[model samples]
Target: MSGDDAKRASDAASARDKLLWIIIYSLCSSTMLVINKLAVGANGLPTVVAGAQLAVSAAVVVVMEFAGAGVLGPFEKKRIVPFVLYTTMFAMGLFSNMKALMLTNVGAVISARCCLPLIVCSIEWFFMNRAFPNARSVMSLMGVVVSAGIYIANDTGVDIQGGAGMFWLLVWWLLLAVQMTYGKHLTENIAMTQWERVFYTNAMAIPPTIVLYYATGENELEMEDGEGAMFYLILSCVVGVAISYSGWKCRSVITATTFTLVGVLNKMATITFTIIVWPKDFSVVKTLALIASVGFGLLYTEAPLRKPKVAGAGTSPLGIKH
Candidate 1:
């Protein structure tokens, strides 16, 4: 084959690898949510549980680095601002999500997160000076919103009266969107490998997470019996933190649109797992609505937008250059 053909083949392989990483990350994240629900239901404190997991994952990364894997690296000074902000956003999103899980059903929380793509897209357009392609994108955003509403309306298990829970869940979704966008910016300049990046991010997160864990009066060593609490904790550390981070590294390679789309699918996986494990009371209408919301969010985020053919030319409708 010609050089051009070889380059195209290489590019296609890279894309496939990235997509595989994303799928693994989404599945791992979904599993983390499920394990978290089980652990919390078994009386595990969310802060302590998550903190411990982070600590263990960090240690594992450290060990891998020492083993000549070159998977972790020294933190860069210039990236501090964005790194800290993104890490803080990560902590807040997780804290809010865990709190919401305690107060509401998993399905409801997942449904509420359906709005995240719209939030991310708007943030990119308005705050970051990006633009969408056409009316189709806007309609797709509306579809997600409407679908989320239908799902929520039909959800009998959701405690709308759980005032603080609802508030925190919405806040969690917003923070997640912001975190992803900011994370993208950080990835643009940071030179670390995927594993190293995850290590550094989690490392920075440790001190704050520990403080929160202690402030919440949660004991790290305390594990309830018969709850599979320990197993869940380990799962969160290995699969959730380590593997999911690997997946997200691939995501940071793609456009923010790809990241959001993967996230929406991850939410769907979480919802499906919740239904299977808990067998909650849910309506077909609600189920369909939830599916639709997730579907639309994926569609909107992945929609092919027009791009400028010339570099440094006028901005394309899709906010990207071809």
Candidate 2:
């Protein structure tokens, strides 16, 4: 084949692979929250549920390695330290999401998450040296925030009487923003395969999750629904592994802003399914707000990285040209 033809073919293959990763991550992540809510609600122990899923994922990694799949890389302080930091925040975010789900309906929780892309994008721009979003993208992001706010204002899905539920949701949102941005950073800058990244994140999260479980007095597992809870827990673990793998794979190919944007957009399916299955406090206004949020999210594009100025040709301390 000619050189130009070969390059074109390779680019096409890369784009196809990227789309596949996006699809896989979206499906697994979208369903994971609902499954986790079911499992946690049944047992009334979010930490226990999260810990179990992480344990299952960690074991899968070990099994893969033993089977000669070679999912893990050699131990190194630099790589391991970043994974540890990310894992700590990951565990906290997972637990807080479960807590939020317990106190509110799926629609409300996911709707609140619509605002995350703005935060993620801003963090990437300031701290990670990513470019600023264009005017159109910024407008779309603002629309997302405004729509999410409208939904939250009209929402009545919180079972909790006061602001405690909102507090948990807010905490989850912030932690998720950090996790998304840092995860993208790891994917871009860290020298590791997708499996290694997945293994490290899932395995390292187990310790902190166990600590949280016991500290929260959730050591005992309650079986309120017998087979139902067990069923959801098992389902959650299965999807957890898939998402763990696909998330890293997806992040490796996409920008932080696009990754977060895909997350918000894919939840349209989740929101529809959620409303159908658990239609608590569903209203026309809320529906319109969701449509607006996802619609505007669709309009967002990943901002290109800023071009370095070439006055002196030496990089600044922040890895950008002065």
Candidate 3:
């Protein structure tokens, strides 16, 4: 082949690989909640379910490391502090997410999650010294908040039955926001490989999850046979591991814009599928609200952080207004 022909062929190959990873990422991301819902809904043991997923994921990482995947890097003592903090937040987020899934429908969870970017960006701005989002982004954030409120108002699921359900959902939302923000901090400030971060987060989360499982008396909760639920729970763990890899793989091959778009599309697909499959407490208003929330979330792009050169200052500051 000529030089141009060779370059074209490589480009085609790259595009194909990117498409494959995008599909994988979408499937894993979309289906995980439904699977977790099935598991927790059947067993009524969100703590155990969450802990099991974490344990399985950690084991997978260990196996991958031993199998010469080269995913494991040398352990650093300095990373332990941040990793532990991240793990505690991660564990709490996982449990609360499972609990929320148990109480609410998939649509409710997705709609609530639409507000996460607002919290995350606020943390970036106030605590991380990042710049505020631009005009369009700010508008989108407002839309997300409003649409999320609409969904919440219209939602008639178990979550809205009383204060406890909303409480768990709020806990999930806040902990997830903290996890995302601090996770970004870990990436920017701490020096660790991606898989190493993954391994540490998953592994360190296991102990706390175990503590929560027994501490909450989930161990004594008598579970029914729930063969189908057991299957779904196992599938949830498998997909949990798959999502970690597929998400990273997709990000490696795609632009930030493409990644964000895929995330939006995946959530839309998940909402649609969940409605079709479960159809519990489904309403036209709720569906439209979810669509609006996710659509607005799509509009919000994170403000880029840039460090300007300072004359004679020895250290560059973190972020500046555009």
Candidate 4:
């Protein structure tokens, strides 16, 4: 076969691999939501439950590292600042997300999170000194807004005045945007293997998570006594972090667009699981609106709306040049 054919085949394989990882990540994320919901139902506090899961996940990653899994180069003395910044940002994002889960419906939380890619783009442009394709970026931003509008219109049970719920949800979105932007920044300087990155990031995230857990007066041991709580906690830690991180690492190798799109699509899993586990009555209009909102979000995040660029054109400092 010609070199061009070989390259095409290679690209196709990579795409398939990325897609698989996306699916895995989405499933894990969805499962985490389900487990979180279960924990709440069992009277477990969101902060405590999530913190426990994160602690376990971090421990697992650390154990894997010590078991000849991967060496940590990114944690070298010089890179500590960037490492801490990204990890703390991630911890804040996770904490906010758990708080939102406690306050709002899963679907609402997921829908609002669709704005993260746009936020990341904006942050890159303003703070990181990166330039995006203007037309494509505008289109994508519009799609996100339209999608969010559809979801909001369709949502019948959402209470805007639900005592800090909406506030927490919005906070979750903002923090996730920060996490993504900072994560991209850290990726630039990190020389560790994917596992090592996951291990260290989660390791660093543990301290803040634990502090939040205790400050909120939530107890991990007490939560485990509740029905199905142990199972939920285990799933949250093992599947949610470990599996999702592995999948994310694989997907990042393909394309930034693919990674962002896949991340957005994971919200659909939340909707799906919510419907299955918490099936609330709704009108046809509402149902259609929800479907459209999610569809638009997927398209907005993943669609190759950006024109293919010439090789070696100016790259985004955030690492999303393509």
Candidate 5:
């Protein structure tokens, strides 16, 4: 083969590897959500569960640091502040998502997540003035909105009509926008590697996470709970680390756009898997809603182009944008 042919083959292999990592990242995240829902929904605790995951993640980072494979870089005052803010919003998102899922079916929670592609774009437009939803995006968004409305009305998923589930979920969704934008700032301005970020964010989060957990009184209560909830909570920690690791690897290989698109598609698989494994009232409307939300959401991903470089942005893996 010609030199050009060899180059093309190498590129194709690289693309395939990235696709495989993306699939792994999606599966880890989606599976963990159902397990989280189960743990918190069963009269367990969200704050404590989040703490456990952070602790496990932090522990892994500490081990990495000891193993000389970690990026325990110098303490920069600039990144520290942003790291704190990012981790705080991240913690809030995690807690609120759990709180919402505890009260509502996982399907409703997943359906609402369809707004992410739109939300992320909206944030970029407002804050960075980078991009906005195009004609195709709007058309695709219409399908997601309509499907969500149908699900909300048809009432396939439970407890959405009443209670604070929708409210918390909305908070979770909005925080996503802030976290993503802040993350871009971190990668571009502060110069933190993915591993450095994983370590710092998890470390910074631990103190605040403890505060959030105890503040909610869940820590005190969960400590008194039965062993089954603890099992799921502990299991969620293992799942969380796996998700983060896969995400870190995937982000190194792909752009934020590709990661988000994979996530949109991942929700479809997650919804299907959640419905199959988790007990829920059967409804065709719900199934269709889940499918349409994800299927149409796929249109939001633009063709493979160079990741848009904003005037003041740096590249980083998709960290905790889920």
Candidate 6:
């Protein structure tokens, strides 16, 4: 076979593998959400529950490190500042999200997050100096966001007004925008491997989560939920390890547009699963939003405007990429 043919075949295999990674990450991440809902519902204190999950993830990473498979880092001085910012964003984003969920109605919570693509895309176009997404991809992503907003508007009453919920949701959105964009930039521009990042960020999460856990107070703590809750918590930890590791790896290979759009789709999966498990009272708007979300997810996946790379180029050259 010609070199060109061999290169094409190799690229096909790699793309297929990355696709598999995205699929696994999305499924695992969606499952983590369900598991979190189950465990946190039984346990109360979302912050403390999050702390436990992080500790679980950390322990698993530690074992991998000792096995010589996922040793964390040399964590060079040059990268320290960015890594600090990365982990801070990581922890705050998650903490705020949990807090928002607790404070708001489902609608408000979802609305707060509906604009994530717009936030991430703006960052990519302006700060990162990347090309804008194609019109179709942008439109489809907008559809996803709009449908979600509509669902929220038509389906539920405002459970909390002029409260901490909106504030936390706004905070969560901004932090997550920074978290993901900086994370991709760190993996793309810096010297850290994916495993080092997975370890460091998970390690970094522990301190903040513990702080949040303590802040939640002794009164909120429940020593015993149930035997079943323990199972869900343990299972959540195992799925979480996959979620963190694959997420880091996937971001390393894709554009911000692709990563966050994939996230929108992942949310759809979680919400879909939520509806199925509980059989919630639904409105016409709610059903439409769910259906449209899945449709847009399919469209975005097929036409995801990825980062520019030279065709059949295995090694990269110096300088900026569009």
Q: Which candidate is the best by lDDT?
A: 2
TM-score per candidate, chains pooled? 0.78, 0.80, 0.71, 0.75, 0.73, 0.84
lDDT of 6 by residue, 57-130 (tens): 77776787789885666657776777778888877777787788888777776665667877887788788877
Task: List per-prediction Cα lDDT, in the order shown.
Answer: 0.66, 0.78, 0.69, 0.60, 0.68, 0.71
Q: What's model 6's lDDT at 31?
A: 80
lDDT of 2 at 73: 82
Q: Name the regions of candidate 6 deviating beyond 4 angstroms.
A: 1-7, 98-104, 157-160, 163-168, 218-220, 283-285, 301-322
Candidate with best TM-score: 6
Off-target runs (Cα >4 Å) in candidate 3 are 1-26, 41-44, 92-113, 157-174, 246-269, 276-280, 307-322
Model 1 CA RMSD to the hidden true structure, in angstroms:
4.8
lDDT of 1 by residue, 1-322 (tens): 9976676566566556666676667767777777777767665577766677777777877888889998855565765666777788887887888788887776677566666777777776665556653466676667866876776666644564378878988888888888877777667766667776676677789888887877677754575664676776666667656554765576665656557756776776566456646677656786777677666654442333344433332222222222
- Order candidates by lDDT, high to low: 2, 6, 3, 5, 1, 4
Q: Which TM-score value belongs to model 6? A: 0.84
Worst 10 residues of 5 by lDDT: 313-322
CA lDDT, candidate 1, residue 321: 20
lDDT for 184 (candidate 6): 76
TM-score of model 1 (CA atoms): 0.78
RMSD in order of candidates: 4.8, 6.3, 7.5, 5.2, 6.1, 4.8
Task: Check candidate 5 and list the clashing pairs.
Answer: 188-314
Better by TM-score, candidate 3 or 1:
1
Model 4: per-residue lDDT, tens digit, 87-143? 777767767777888877755765676656666666666766555535544565556
